[model samples]
Target: MDQKLTLNGNPITLTGYNINGNNYFMLRDIGRAVGFSVAWNGSTRTVEIDTARPYEEEQPADSVAPTDGSRYVPQVGDTIRCPDGTDYTITDVSRWDKNAFVSGPLGELPQPTCDWSSFPEIELPAAEVRHFQLESGEYLFIRNLYETRRMQYTLQNLAGNHPDTSKDGKLAYGGKGSPAVSIKLSIPSEISAYSFWPWRESEIENLFHSCPPGTYYMEAWDVYKDGVFQRTEYNIRAV
Candidate 1:
């Protein structure tokens, strides 16, 4: 049989046997749960327990538990075991958001970087950044996307507009009979950027209030299509 156990708010699953209608867990499993050493003495024909040492599993590579009985801190290009007993390879780490995005047998999933207790707060000039902290303890940083004047002029010229006379100053352009070209905005310093979409101030505020506690990244921009106001696009991601 299998048994589920919770120790100090951490959930652990162990194999057990049913004897006389009562569940009996293996000594090794109990040792693992309580952070102690367990071993089998072949010559002595006995089970040995060492309370002074930490628990270490002599299992397969993929299912090995932490030797020191501490939480696993994942990093890029590393394979880690999840709580569901599956292996995942981390591909990227978002330092600003403190999340490690991984792909493996279970597909893509976001895992928190639990080792970090806190991240450096973003501090930028008022002309560029806005920071918020929700009641749920999530940190959010929103910044305006800025482009150099030369880059803006070059984009205007490519879109068939007069670089000197075009007064629209749109970020996104799609002229008639021409392929639509959008400016590739750079992420702000000390922040991470993920998805980009048009969003309003009210909508952003609502999302900030509703999201769960975690670090969040966002980049805001005023996007235009053919000299007309389309929307303010936001690239948002949670760490």
Candidate 2:
């Protein structure tokens, strides 16, 4: 007689001999396949099969496991992103209010009651810049000081090129055999002018590396709590 055997309504492969309409299979194979531990108990002279349980000897009894990265204590100058996708840099820590004062796009402000348990610490990348040589032999450099406090310093105006005030206007290059181009710099919201570099995304030294040898009008816009508070201009020569 041929008969099929199933467990929990699921077919289980069995290699056994049929006797009196009953089938017997290897106990260890079935136990392993079904996520059970099969062990021989010498004193009881019986096989013990139970649900698999991981050993917890390595962990402390009172320990609590974290779902993601390790626990982080907030500190001043540390940047954090809220659940709502707003990024802020901690400016002050107040234990009395149980909140942190942070700098955001709006201005210096205080965040809601801080509970960093669910929030993961993130490191915002450094600022980036792109250069577009204008048709006037001048350079309209675009800088993005992303998520950081910084300043943009204009070096020289040897080319004596005035700002291309035309909306989306094309600028021609002044150098010999140089191609004329038109491009505008999109200033990021997070960037504002400063007299000196701040804690995050400072690229003061990068200026020398990005621009080629040229004379151009350089300026700096200082970002403040309200907005762009000051502008400084200078004559610069890049060689």
Candidate 3:
């Protein structure tokens, strides 16, 4: 289904979970449309979409299709009014966030949109500390941990080889004694963007403060890519 984003002038096509049930989406897919580079600022839990595009008033739901059942599906060339009513183009179609039913071949709306039938839960890996230097002369230290679930997050202090879950479901590598996760600081020269973990509710707020902005959220997926242990990225940013 074509979705109206509140950032750019194009409609975002939908995949994976149909427009019917709840589903997950990517930050970068909508990041460029919003004029911001999605980054992972571990210090704060803030998905910063930096855009020169001034914030416009959100368009009313009035623009939605007439409730003839055709009103709730995804379609090609469909009008995707961003939250602000900006027109954006739907470029492609594929299964987003991994699963699909809602995500199918590109077809215009008036057709039934996809919906997510199932969403599983996941657990975060123990924290692994990683550090970087920012242009601000400050250090952004990230305690990177991974969770392979779909539900909520639990923060914990991973000291040994295994990190436990936090009271709120958040997790982090204990301290220096634990494994220190490293990140390649240089920006990606290709489509392979790096990811780090950050939570607004996490205890490490100072590390998230040293970012260059445009940070996004931590994404979670299956452990193996195509059936391997390829580490996936997060979908969050430092606040």
The CA-based lDDT of model 3 is what?
0.30
lDDT of 2 by residue, 98-192 (tens): 21332433233223222222222223333222222345421211122221212111111111122321112222344463322211122234434
Candidate 3 per-residue lDDT, tens place, 1-239, comes to 45544434655564334545866565656554454565543235355555755334334332322222121222333333333333332222232222422233223312111211111222344333222234543221222232212212221122111223122222222355321222221223343443442222232232333441222234332122111222223433332
Instruction: Report the Cα RMSD per candidate.
Output: 20.2, 21.9, 22.1
lDDT of 1 by residue, 88-205 (tens): 3333344312223322222122223221112222232233222223464322222333312222222224332323222243222235422233333344565665443332234334
**In every candidate, how many clashes are there?**
2, 25, 62
Question: Whose lDDT is greatest here?
Answer: 1
Task: Please give each candidate's TM-score.
Answer: 0.23, 0.18, 0.20
- Runs in model 2 deviating more than 4 A are 1-12, 54-239
Q: lDDT of each prediction vs. the true structure? A: 0.41, 0.31, 0.30
Query: Best by TM-score, which number?
Result: 1
After superposition, which runs of candidate 1 have C-alpha atoms over 4 Å from their true positions? 59-239
Cα deviation in Å at residue 84, candidate 1? 25
Residue 39 of candidate 2: its Cα lDDT? 65
Which residue pairs show backbone clashes in model 1?
A: 195-235, 197-234
